[model samples]
Target: MARYNSWQNRSLIRAAEALTDAARWQDRGAFFGSIAATLNHLYWADALILARLMGNERPQDTITHSLTNPADWQDYRLLRRRRDRQIERWAADLKDAELSGTVVWYQAGGATRVTTSRALCAVQLFNHQTHHRGQVHAMLTAAGAKPDVTDLTSLG
Candidate 1:
């Protein structure tokens, strides 16, 4: 799981870096408007799920709050680097026992629900990242930017 997390983070970072040459803040038809916004959403969603798993208060009120306008490529890259480090650290320190426990939390819509385990929550977090990143990649390509290779084996 840790290995997969590491690879996913690296893959996300690489893809984001590849788009640096394109417009960083311009809306390229992504749901979040721009690459920066889409990537920010991805990071925030991961953090939100991680926080829920650990019984911590979410920093953002809504997932939409995570959307951002990082006009500078360097700043966007730095933020992504930090997020990747956070993901790596979380994955490294995660315990097998914790993965099996139920996570009870309130949904953003104010509904209460219980997750069976952190493992499943973690899977959702990573999967969410991939799903949105794919959207950003398509927007990048449509905007005439060359997206990074997305194959998992290539990431290895």
Candidate 2:
């Protein structure tokens, strides 16, 4: 899933790269308002989720800036590439025993929760990426900047 996610994200990044900053930021009425907003939200969410999965904390000082808007394209590209690499590496390291374990977490907007199955958390995490990536895919297509195929078969 991490390999797939990174492949899809690379496509989005490439498509986004073709746009001027203003074009990338133009409002097209998606949930996050623009391509930039959508991507930034994905990264922000990934940071939180990845931190939880890794049992480590992200540098807090960077959260506010990223959640508001991703770093400028060059910076964001670097940050996102790093993030995708981490996800891929971590996913590669998972063991079958770990998949059956429980994952407990807290989201800021609400209370604590537990997943009886770590596999469930993995499912949700990857599904979350696909969900938002679909939104951005539509937005990008409408804007005539659609990336190459994102289907897992194609990625594989």
Candidate 3:
């Protein structure tokens, strides 16, 4: 799933790169309002969720503020690519015993601490990426950018 996440992100980001800055950031009336914003949201969520899974410090940015930074397409792309590699490395190192272990972290505002199985947290990270990436795929297609196939089987 980490590989798939990275693969699809590469495709989507590459396709998004074909568009003008104005086009990529243009409001298309989607949930996040534009491809750029939606991708930013995904990057934010992935960073936070992956941090949780890896037992790292939770990001200081709240969900409401997730879309505020890395506004430049190049910066967002670089950070996202680096994040994908980090997630892949973490996934590769995970042992079967760790799957049953629990990860504890604070929710968005640090108000409540929640504990969950490492397995479920992993799924949440990947699933959340796919969900929002779909939104980006739709917006990209609407803007006439052709991302490569999203099929997991298509990953080489």
Order of candidates by lDDT, top first? 3, 2, 1
Candidate 3 stretches with Cα past 4 Å from truth are 61-65
User: Regarding TM-score, does 2 or 3 come out ahead?
Assistant: 3
Model 3 residue 14 lDDT? 94
Give per-model TM-scores: 0.75, 0.87, 0.91
Measure candidate 1: CA RMSD.
3.4
Score each candidate by Cα lDDT. Answer: 0.66, 0.78, 0.85
Please give the lDDT score for candidate 3: 0.85
What is the lDDT for 33 in model 2?
A: 84
Task: Record all residue pairs in model 3 with backbone atoms less than 3 Å apart, i.e. clashing.
Answer: none
Residue 72 error for model 2, in Å?
0.7
Pick the lDDT winner: 3
lDDT for model 1: 0.66
lDDT of 2 by residue, 1-156 (tens): 899999999999998877888877888999988888889888877876766565433323344525446648887888889989988888999888877766666545335454446677677778899999999898888888969887678965
Ranking, TM-score, top scorer first: 3, 2, 1
> Per-residue CA lDDT of candidate 1, range 74-99, in tens?
77667666767777788788877878
